[model samples]
Target: MPQLTQTEMFLAVLVAIFALPYAVWRLGRTDYYAPLVVVQIVGGILLGPGVLGAALPQLHATLFTPDVIAMLNGIAMWAVMLFVFVAGLELDLKAAWRWRGETGTTAALAFTTPMALGALVAGALLLLDARGEWVGAEGQDWQFVAGVGMACAVTALPILVLFLEKLAILRQPLGQRVLRYASLDDLAIWGVLALILLDWERVGRQAAFIALFVPAVWAMRAAMVRLAERDRWYVALVWVALLGLAADWSGLHFMVGAFLAGAVLDGEWFGTERVDRFRDTVLLALMPVFFLSTGLKTQWSAGGWAVAMFALALLVASVGGKLGGVALAGRLLKWPRGEARLIGWLLQTKALILIIFANVLLDKQVITPATFTALLLCAVASTMLTIPFATPALRQLDTHRA
Candidate 1:
């Protein structure tokens, strides 16, 4: 038998990366519950060490050789950076501010409530485990708890956008309201991440990065405004890359920089239609590999059952806390009975953002692989619940209106 060359092997891995998810998502018709992105994510896990590697160690090792893994990681890094940057750009802060009173009340409660519940659960795990399997080697107890809590609190803005569009409410008043709330929370989530990633030794560098970033944003915005729309797209890619480099150099991580780069620029410059196409293109072309790379990180070393239970616990905290908070906000704000229920279920969508958050935590060694796996599961489950649960609420609201 002739052995394949390195390039040949890399191509094979790519085939597996793209094929499996499409097959499952299309043939199984999982899109009603799980979007293609979600299926890709689950497929990635299936291809990763815990399942495929365990089942066929030799094939896994041979297919994902060191060079191929490196190549895949490279693609995943850029793909996610692009995804995060688009997410930041899509944030309509103006709309959020316009409705600040209601949006603030809803966003604040929606975020803080789940955070607290998730933190409590994390602390409980610490008490029960005794071996500290959940916390990362470089993490403090507080960081671990805070990271987990934030994971629960996050609403994946990009995923929420997808869901809204799917439900045919993307342009409606209710969809706009939900987007405003998610936008504010999206900003808060990144701020909390910066805090979690703070290193005392690198505090000065981080401060300098923030200081420099203001002028950088000013320059980027000025340049973007003057350029032709065609030119702006190319320039934006350069901007994302530079900020990613700067952010990583400052010990804050490239995704942080990528997001900051997009956050400062007005999405209007790109045109909504173009932005939508660009985001969809990135997802279709690049993010499958990112999902695959994410799957490769899954570990069940602490025992599969333990991880499964932890995921379930986190899921309850995420779902229940989100609904509870929104329900309270509805009562306080005098929202119609079912309005908050609809919003709560809509905001419960969490996939891309939560996975990215957990990935950062794992990268920073603030959480163990087992903990990351649990959070990943919680994210997938939460996102899957969004469409199923929200559809009913939407119909009920429509009925009431009728």
Candidate 2:
């Protein structure tokens, strides 16, 4: 293996750290949340082995390493946590409680229907395309199937919030309902993923440990919230550090701990404004580094027919399952027809959360390089499709209500 010279490494870091923020800042002027992903992807490609290697081959080798990859994963997890915490902060717990009846039904339908459909679709794809007979640890069959199912059933609540805010609809009745549903959707999907991970014999014990660790950390957070309420900054620091440590100790990713900490402190220790400030700083600073890291790690050449089939299965299951389930639930619950269809479509958009979960599966070796790349492509495509499909419906509804 070749090592990068000191100069090359320093330049790579400088490009990752500086270039992303400048791009984000410029993008923020037009659409505060829209351009970060695009910019980071472009930045990564520019700094990555593909482009950089073609230009300055030496710098490329130095920047790619196990250590650097791990750092990128950590940063990605943190970015995800910050994003999820922001989502939690935006949740109207009160409204969620009020709509508990409808919300519960919608959530159950949304999670179960998509998950089951995704699993079935994935299984069929594996049978058709996969080489091996048994699809397990050796074959990577179960992992691919589960990954597709998860991608299909998942929703990025944070992205949904960003969309709502961009449209200036956060406080509207329909927006409020969508927000609450998205929150419930996230909780349900994550819980299901945790359960699925636990079912894996190799990592079952570790998953069990993390599951048990949640409440224990919640107890600690309960104490920290009381103490931090007195001195906000001190408490925030302590909370963040403790959360990161707990997640590490529990054999779970740090972002899980960060999100749980945020949830525990939500509405109690940190107010919306302060949380917003912290998020903006983190987004502007560390989040871009994380996305660039993912972009840097992604290799399109790894993809094959098997991966292509898996990605297609995920894309279809996610859209069809979520849309069909939500639509059915809406009619069954007697929601307005248009409103029901819109909700279904909106909930199908997958972005940050899908990427985060795909990384997790990748780390666990549950997804191959090719499969992971395909899933990322699927997420980007689905998110792009979402805006065009949902925007008109949302606008029409707004006009009707007015």
TM-score (all chains, Cα) for each model: 0.99, 0.81
Per-residue C-alpha lDDT of model 1 across residues 284-310, encoded as one tens digit per residue: 999999988999999999899999999
**Total clashing pairs for each candidate:** 0, 0
Q: List the residue pairs that clash in candidate 2.
A: none
- Identify the candidate with maximal lDDT: 1
Q: In candidate 1, which residue ranges exceed 4 Å CA deviation?
A: 129-131
Give per-model CA RMSD.
0.9, 4.3
- TM-score of candidate 1 to 2 decimals: 0.99
How well is each residue in 276-342 modelled by candidate 2, as lDDT tens digits? 6776776667676766666665554533465566667678888888888988888888886478777
